[model samples]
Structure formats: C-alpha cells, structure tokens
Target chain A: GESVGLHLPTLSVQEGDNSIINCAYSNSASDYFIWYKQESGKGPQFIIDIRSNMDKRQGQRVTVLLNKTVKHLSLQIAATQPGDSAVYFCAENWSGGSNYKLTFGKGTLLTVNP
Target chain B: DVKVTQSSRYLVKRTGEKVFLECVQDMDHENMFWYRQDPGLGLRLIYFSYDVKMKEKGDIPEGYSVSREKKERFSLILESASTNQTSMYLCASSSSTDTQYFGPGTRLTVL
Candidate 1:
C-alpha cells in the first residue's frame, strides 16, 4: 500500500535557528501537497501547499519544497520561535481516477528552545 | 474567513453508547470531511461528503457513518462506541481548490 511518512518523529531547534521537517511519499500519482501545523489540543492548521508542477513555494516564514524524482517533501521554517513549537504534518493529494483524498504523514513534533 | 465549527470541544461516553459528532461550516462549501487523529496514526479520514446528501466512505470507515442532509452541516455517528474509539475528531470543509479549513476539533473519551 502507498503511504506518506516523516523522516523524524521529533526535532529540537534554537529560537533563532531555522528548522526543517522532512517527509517521504510513496505514491507517484499524487499531485498536490500541503503542510499543516497543529498545536496542543487544537486541530491541524493549513500552512502552505505546493503543486507537483512546481518544486518550491514560499509563504510568510515558511517554505515547502517538493522533489518528484525522490518522492520527497520538506517544510522549512526560518527564525524559529517558542510560539512555533508544535507538530507538523505533510499531506499528499491525488486528483486522478476519482481520488480527491488527502493522505497525511504521521507528523514531526517540533520544539523551539528559548 | 471560512469558519468550521464542531458541536463539542470534549465529549465523554460509555462503551456501547451511541455517539454523535456534529460539524457546521459557514462558508457554504460543497465538501466536508470527518477525521480522527491519534498519537502515531496521524489523521485518518472517516467519511466525506462532496455535496448535499452525497457521502463517501474513506480509508477507515468501518464503525462510523455520516449524514449530510443539508449543505452547511455534516454529522458523524458512531453506532456503538468502544474504548478504542477514544481520539480527537476533526472536521474540515473545502471547495474546488481542495484547501481544507479545519475546526477546533473534539476530544472524545470512551470509557
């Protein structure tokens, strides 16, 4: 079965440092990808998304990079802050063959130190 | 802003009890989804409705059912709640773009 997964379960970074979260997807037919941020006791919030046609997309302090060749995706956050500590998940969406579902990765817990 | 609201922020139910989780979206979107988030399972879709009265079973929809009688509201029903059903329920709505807007979520505990 095809699935999406994260490279790491947890990541710790300093307040001023940059943080990167990695994801690997097995489905080659997936076209759209999204990044979500979930805080404690809250639902996942949409951060940024990228289509398969493009390799990278940027929003605010966040950037999403996609590599179709390696079936890999990454989310980069610049100038990490304490408020940015949360769990991040990568989701892949396939539009082919009556498939409009989004497959989500297990997620990576990000901790920003003061 | 697209606002999706769930009926409860937290719920407690006993085993074998019937559970209902409600979600409403103010954006009048045509797509609504119900998902459960667990510790290491990420988010698993229980069900989704693309339009009024049209429902589709998701990846994990064995013990769950959905009803979408109206355009703005979608409901998830658990026939017989069990201890394994304890999880965080999330509701989301989207349009043709497929960018979902999620609600605050409801934490359910079945004891």
Candidate 2:
C-alpha cells in the first residue's frame, strides 16, 4: 500500500513464523533505501539498508528486496519474536537532493504473537 | 557505533514561546537533521545541517530553524511555538556517506 500519512500498514505474524513488511516509495531517482524499527517510547533504529544498484540484500536473519521498476521495498524477517513488535519505517534517499535527506514512509507496525 | 543524543525525552511549551531542541552525535558526523513525527502524517523533514555553520530548510520548515555551530551538534529552534507543532521530534546524524543514526526522540507538547 501507499504511504498516505501517519498510518502505517501492519503485518501480523505468529512467533517462529516469517514476517514481511512492504513499502512503496515515490521517487524513482532514490539511490539508497533503509529500513528502521521504532519501539514504543523509543526512536527509530536502523535495521538494514539497500542501495538502488542492488535489487536484494541480506542481513543477519533479515533481507531487503528492492523493485526499482515498481518503486517498492520489502523487509523479510525470519523467526518472528515478540521483540520484533514495533513500527517499521522505510526511508529513501535521493543523492541528487541538496541535503541528500531521506524521505521516510509512514511505517508498518509488525505485531508478532507468542 | 554511532550514538545520537537528544537533550530531553519529553517537554512542554506554551504558544508564542520559543523552544529549543538539542541533538548531539558522537560519531563526528558531518550531517545532522531534525524531523517531526505526527499521527497519520508520518515523519516530515524540518531542517538539516550538512556542516558546521551550514543549515538548510527541509520540506516543512516554515515554522522552524536550525543551528549547527559545531560538527557534532545540531539545534532546532521554534521562534514562536504553536500548538500545531506538538509532535515527536527526532534527531539524526550521518557521515558524508552512511546511514542515519537517530536519537531517542523528544516529545514536545504545545499548549
């Protein structure tokens, strides 16, 4: 789904299951993309990032897939844990911008059930 | 590891009063930014500083200003705070080429 505002699309997963969060960005020129996890009462924490050149990147138990043609990004989490319950944000960076600032999407609150 | 620190986790302010939010980074990053998070509005850029003494306005910078006197610190200023400004302010820092490291965040309530 598109990022309309502060509303983040959510993904619910059972413990020990895999979870996938999706985001669709607006800028085609964005060269880099990053995903973040923000727990309640805390700020957004960096999870993983991918450069536009690469369609897919893997991390420790996590993977990021980029579809430039669709301007979409997804985060895959393995073996979901309750600790994984938090709002996840996807950010895009266009190197052409003056500040190279990242544009953040609303976010997806992933709820992992134990 | 990059560590970004904010002065306050929560704050209260009155309308028409000035407000300041401070952010510091230990990574000696050259770039720092300020953003506001609101319900159903996502995170919007307020301002950013690319280097000491250099600052730029982001998309929604009409009511905010920024200062970066040193490479490690960035401050956001509200000339005349308004209730509409009530939201979660996040501070972030990045080197010339790296991911942004965020602070815990500052929740400001304007009444």
Candidate 3:
C-alpha cells in the first residue's frame, strides 16, 4: 500500500535558525499536500498547503515545496522560536471526489532551543 | 475562525464499557471526520460523515462507529472499549473543498 512518511523523526534547532521538515509520499495520484503543527496536548493545526499544479507555496514565514516526480514534500520555517517546538505532520490528499480525506505521515518532533 | 470542540479532553473507561466521544463544529461545514492518533502510527481515519444522517467508513473503522444527527455535530462510538483502543482521538470539519480544521483532541485510556 502506498503511504506518506517523514525522513526524520526528530529535529533540534536553535532559536532564529531556519528549520526544514521533509516528507516522502508513495502515491503518485496525490494532488494536494498539507502541513500541520501540533503543540503539546493539542490537536494538529493547519499550517500551509500546496497543490500538485504548483511546486511551491508560501505562507507567513513558512513555505511548502512539492516535487511530483520524486514524490517528495517539504516544509520550511524561518526564524525558529521556542514556541515553534512541536510535532509537525505532512498529509497527502489524493485526487478523487468530495470526501477530502487525508493520509498523514507519522510526524516529526521539532525542538527549538532558546 | 473555525472552531471544532470535543466533549472531553481526557477520558478513562473500563474494558467492555461503551464509550462515546462527541465533537461539534461551529462552522456549519458539510464534512466531518474522526481519527485516532497513536505513537508511530500517525492518524488513522475511523469514520466520516459528509452530511446529516449519512456516514462512511474510513481506513480503520472496524471497532468504531459514527453518528451525525445534526450538521454541526459528529460523534464516535466504541461498542466495547478495550485496552488496545486507548489513543488520542481527534475530530475535524471542513467544507467539501476547504481544508480541515481540528479540535483539541480527546485522550482516551481504556483500563
């Protein structure tokens, strides 16, 4: 079965440094991808998303890059802060009907040191 | 803001007990979903409802069921809770074409 997965399970960065989280998806039919941030004791919050038509999309201090050929996706965060410490997940939405259900990666735990 | 709320933040139930987890969304979205998150397992969809009185089984729906009596509410039910059912359950809602907004998840422990 095709699945989405992260390259790293944990990442540690210092404050003000740039951070990157990587994901690889196996389903070639996936047309939409999203990044989510989950703080401790909370649900995952939507961060940014990109459609397969575009390779890159940017949101407030964050960018999502997609590589359809390689079936890879990545999320970049700028000026990492202590508050940014959390688990980040990447989800792939395959092209289909109106269900809009997503397949999520296991997630990467990000730790930002102040 | 799209706010999705769950009935409880933490719940503990005995084995064989019936468990119900309620979720409500204020955005009046047409789609709602239930997922269980476990360590190293990511998020597995339990069930989803696209409209009132309509339901669909998701990837992992063997031990769970759902109810969507109203447009704003969706509920997940465990017929017979077991220790293996313990996990963090999350609820989300979205329009047919919109991104999903999630609730503060409910941590369930079946002892």
Candidate 4:
C-alpha cells in the first residue's frame, strides 16, 4: 500500500489461521508483480510472483491474486504459522522487454500469535 | 541455487567517516542495485548499475555513491556518515529478467 501519512499498515493473525494481506500499486505499465517476506534480521525472500497477463497464481501454501483494473494485489496464506510472521512487501515491475525498475510497497507487518 | 552475500551484518561508524559496504553475488547477474530500508519508509533505491563501470542514480541519491567494477561485486560508499543515514542497506542482483535476488542486508548505524 502507499504511505498514508507517516505510518505503515500492519496486521496480526493467530497461529493456525488463514491470513490475507492487500496492497495497492500506482504503476499502470508494470507487467510483473511480486511478493516478498522479510524476517527481523534478513533480507527479503521471494514468496510469489504474477504477471499482468495472469490474474491469479498459486504457490506452495501461498496464493497471489492480481487485479490489473484497480492496480490491487493480495497475498493469501493458508493455515498461517508462527514462522510466517514477518514483514511482507509487494513490488511491481514493467519487465516486458527492457530494463524495468521495481517499485515496492510500504510493507505490512504480520504478527502470527500462538 | 542463487547466493548473495553481504560483507557485514551490522556496521557502526562515526559522523564524517567514510563507509563502504560490499556485496557479492554467486550468480552471474548483470544488474545490481543498492537500496535503503527504513522502519516506516519502505525500500528506496539509491543507485543501480547494469554493467561494470556503468551506474545510474536512483530515486534518492543524495549523500550516497556506488561502484561496480566487477560483475559479481557492487559496493556502496557513504562519503560522510550522518545520523540521518542510519538505516538498513540492502544489495540486490538479477538476471536480465529482473527477478531480483537480495543479499543479507547490512544495518548501518552512524553516530
């Protein structure tokens, strides 16, 4: 999501439950969108990716939905575990041909409570 | 498997000191980028290079510089460390496809 004013949006989910995090992008020319997970001390790891030609893509226990009409994207994790707790960010790229720069979201902190 | 390694996990420097952060990628990637991640502010691109000896200033380039003398190595240099520059610095590399692989970030604190 875009920066509202000064703070980033966050979500907390209970362990063993499902969780959904949403993001809105501003680029209309972006052809690829991706989601990344980052722990407290590590860099962002790739979770999933989707192309503008596709509306939905699913990975192992994680699903990503893209709505190009509204430039919105969502990530769904089934049976969220405590290890799933981290900061999630959505990035968009226009990598159809030439060098494309990736634009990242403000990030959403997901806390999975046990 | 792709591997990206950062020279340091944590770094602290005094004000007006010159700082250098190193990054190495095992995969032969042509494009490398340097970014800073803050608590509230997401990741902001500082600099990027597509080829050795070629560099471009990203969205925010003030007070930051970058060097890419080799294909697998990219270095970020802070001319004079400042308190405002205290943040998590990340280095990333990608094939021509643009799916980036990031290294373990280096958290730089300037006093």
Among these predicted structures, which one has the highest DockQ?
Answer: 3
| Runs of candidate 3 exceeding 4 Å displacement | none
C-alpha positional error of residue A58 in candidate 2 after TM-score superposition, expressed in Å: 1.3
* Tens-digit per-residue lDDT, B1-111, candidate 4: 889999999999999999999999989999999999998688999999998999999989999999999999999999999999999999999988858888899999999
- Report the Cα lDDT for candidate 3: 0.94
TM-score (chain A only) of candidate 1 = 0.97
**Which 10 consecutive residues of model 4 chain B have the lowest summed lDDT?**
B94-103
Model 2 CA lDDT for position A112: 92
Candidate 2 wrongly placed segments (more than 4 Å):
A1-8
Top model number, lDDT: 3
TM-score of 3: 0.97
lDDT of 2 by residue, A2-109 (tens): 232223487888999998888888777889999999999799999999998999999998999998898788899999899999999889888876766887888898
lDDT digits (tens) for residues B1-111 of candidate 1: 889999999999999999999999999899999999988778999999999999999889999999999999999999999999999999999986778889999999999
Better by TM-score, candidate 4 or 1: 1
- DockQ of candidate 2, scored on C-alphas against the true complex (2 decimals): 0.82
Candidate 2, residue B47: the lDDT equals: 87
Which stretches of candidate 1 lie above 4 Å from their native place?
none
Ranking by DockQ: 3, 2, 4, 1
lDDT (C-alpha) at residue A69 in model 4: 95
